[model samples]
Target chain A: SQTIHQWPATLVQPVGSPLSLECTVEGTSNPNLYWYRQAAGRGLQLLFYSVGIGQISSEVPQNLSASRPQDRQFILSSKKLLLSDSGFYLCAWSPTGGEQYFGPGTRLTVT
Target chain B: AQTVTQSQPEMSVQEAETVTLSCTYDTSESDYYLFWYKQPPSRQMILVIRQEAYKQQNATENRFSVNFQKAAKSFSLKISDSQLGDAAMYFCAYTERSQGNLIFGKGTKLSVKP
Candidate 1:
């Protein structure tokens, strides 16, 4: 079975600091990757999505950016973080025309 | 752009009873997909059910099923014999046929009482 993994299950970063979050899929090649954020009491917000390597689409424009360095590896980074950047980050994967599978998620707190 | 709406911010049901969570969407395209996702206190997002706009028959998985009214653009989820485990924040999502993006609603928090 295919699985998704996310690093730093929980993170605490100071304001104006840099940010780097990684997501990887195992047992699946060329899968669609997505980055979503859930605020304290809100729904999932699609931040970015990638259909293939080196291809990325931004759903919402902000301080965050996403990159697909490899076929199954996606990275979310920021040169400087903002206080509003704090939220629960979820990484998901799906096959073309298929339902998405979510990773364990990373709770990022930007103080 | 496709949009999903879940009017109920919170709902509660007695254990072993049935509960229906309402979800409606708006889209100009005829070909699309609707989904219901469950997010537990653990914060993991899980797919509860999905309905294709082309399929007239509602999709069902075990105790979960959908009431898809394509013409009305309404897709509601029904959970039979609701259990404590069923308590969670349920979100309604939509994705157009040609798009890879899944748009989500604000979500409804469901609580099960024993």
Candidate 2:
């Protein structure tokens, strides 16, 4: 069975600080990875997705950026965080294009 | 572009009852996929059910099922014998077969009464 892991289950960062969130998948190779953010009581917003290493497509234009450094490792980063950047961040993986499985997620709070 | 819509912001059902959450999507392409995801209080997104556009039969997984009306562009999720554990925010999502990226709806919050 395949499983996804995310680091820093919860994070608190000061405004203008750097941000880094990591996601990794085990038991699967060459899987599609995605980064999503959900505001309080709102639905998810797709930030970025990668089909392969070094390849990334961004859906929303914001301060955040994503990278696929390895086949199963994905990283979401920002040089300077904004107050609007605080939200629940989710990492998801899909074998094909149909169903996606999500990780535990990271709750980021920018003060 | 493909778009998904979930009109209901919140819904509630008593335990052991059946509840249906409505979803509709707009797309120009014929080859696509629809999915329902559950987000609990923990905020973990879980796949509840999925429907393929080419398939006529509705998809069912255990106590959860989807009503896939391709022509109407409607895909609804039905929860049978609802349990307290079923309480969560449900989201409707659509993705093109070749696109691979998913477009999600606003989501509906479901509450199960004990």
Candidate 3:
């Protein structure tokens, strides 16, 4: 069975501060990884997706960026946080073009 | 470009009854996939059901099923014997066969009353 992990479960960052959120999947290799954001009372919006290491496809243009440093390790980062950057971040993984499985997610608040 | 639409912002159902949440999508591709995901109060997205465009038969899980109308571009989720645990925000998503990325709808908040 494959499982996905993300941390910190919750985060609070001040404006202009750096941001880093980590996601790692165990029991799978060369999986497709994705980053999605959900604002309060809204649906999810895809931010970025990676089919392989060092290959990322961005969907939304914003302050955030994503990187797949390893086969199963993906990171979402930002040099400076904005108030609009606050939202719930979710990490998901799929087998090639298969259905996606989600991580526990991280609640980020930028004050 | 593919787009998913879930017009219902909220719905209510009685426990042990049935409720249907509507979803429609637009896509130029013939082979694709449609999915229904549930986000509980905990906000974890859980896959409820999925339908493949090539298949004509409706996909069904234990208590969840889908009405897939390829021509109509309508895919609706039906929950039978609804339980309190079924209360959640349901989302409709679409993806192409060659694309791993998904396009999601606004979602419908389902409330179950006992």
Candidate 4:
């Protein structure tokens, strides 16, 4: 069985502060990783996705970025956060042409 | 571009009853996949069920079954003998054939009253 882990299940950051969220998958290799954000009571919006290491595809233009540093490790970062950046950030992994498996998720509050 | 729609924003059902959530999608591709994901207050997106476009038979997993209407471009989820734990926000999602990204709808909040 494969399990996905994300760090800092919840966080509160001041505007203009740096942000970093990590996601890793265990028991799977070379899986597709994705970054999504969901506003309160809203559907998820895909931010970024990576098919392989060092290859990230951004779905929407935003202040955040994602990196696939390793086969099972993915990182979402931002140099300076904005108030609008606050949301429920989620990390998901999927096998090639397979359904996605989501992590526990990180709730970010930009104050 | 593909678009998913869940008409009901919120619905409630009594425990031990049956409930069906409606979903419809717009896409030009013939081959793709549709999925229903449940998000509890805990905020984890759990895959409830999935249906492939090429299949005619409805996909069923225990008490959860999908009504896949290919001709109408509608995919609905039916929960049988609903339990209190079935209360959650149900989202309808669509993925392109051989593609990785999932396009999701606004989601419907299902409340199971005990």
* All candidates: DockQ: 0.72, 0.87, 0.79, 0.77
**Which docking band does candidate 3 fall into?**
medium
Candidate 2 lDDT, tens digit per residue, A1-111?
999999989999999999999999999999999999999998888899999999999998999999998999999999999999999999999999668899999999999
- What is the docking quality class of candidate 2? high
Once all C-alphas are superposed, what RMSD does model 3 give against the true structure? Answer: 0.6
Clashing pairs in 2: none
Chain A (candidate 4) TM-score to true chain A: 0.98
lDDT of 3 by residue, A70-101 (tens): 99999999999999999999999999675799
Candidate 1, B6-110: lDDT as tens digits? 999999999999999999999999888889999999899999998888999999999999999988999999999999999999999998878868899999999
The C-alpha stretches of model 3 lying farther than 4 A from their native spots are: none
Off by over 4 Å in 1: none
Best prediction by DockQ: 2
- Mind giving the per-residue lDDT tens digits that candidate 4 earns over A4-103? 9998999999999999999999998999999999999999999999999999998899899889989999999999999999999999998975579999
- What are the clash counts of all predictions, listed in order? 0, 0, 0, 0
lDDT, model 4, position B96: 81
Compose the digit string of candidate 2's lDDT tens values, residues B1-114: 678999999999999999999999999999998999999998999998888899999999999999998889999999999999999999999998888788999999999999
Clashing pairs in 1: none
- Each candidate's B-chain TM-score, in sequence, is 0.98, 0.98, 0.98, 0.98
RMSD of every candidate to native, in Å, equals 0.8, 0.7, 0.6, 0.7
lDDT of 1 by residue, A1-111 (tens): 899999989999999999999999999899999999999999999999999999999989999999998999999999999999999999999887457889999999999
Candidate 2 vs candidate 3: the DockQ winner is 2
Shift in Å, residue B77, candidate 3: 0.4
Model 2 residue A107 CA deviation (Å) reads 0.4
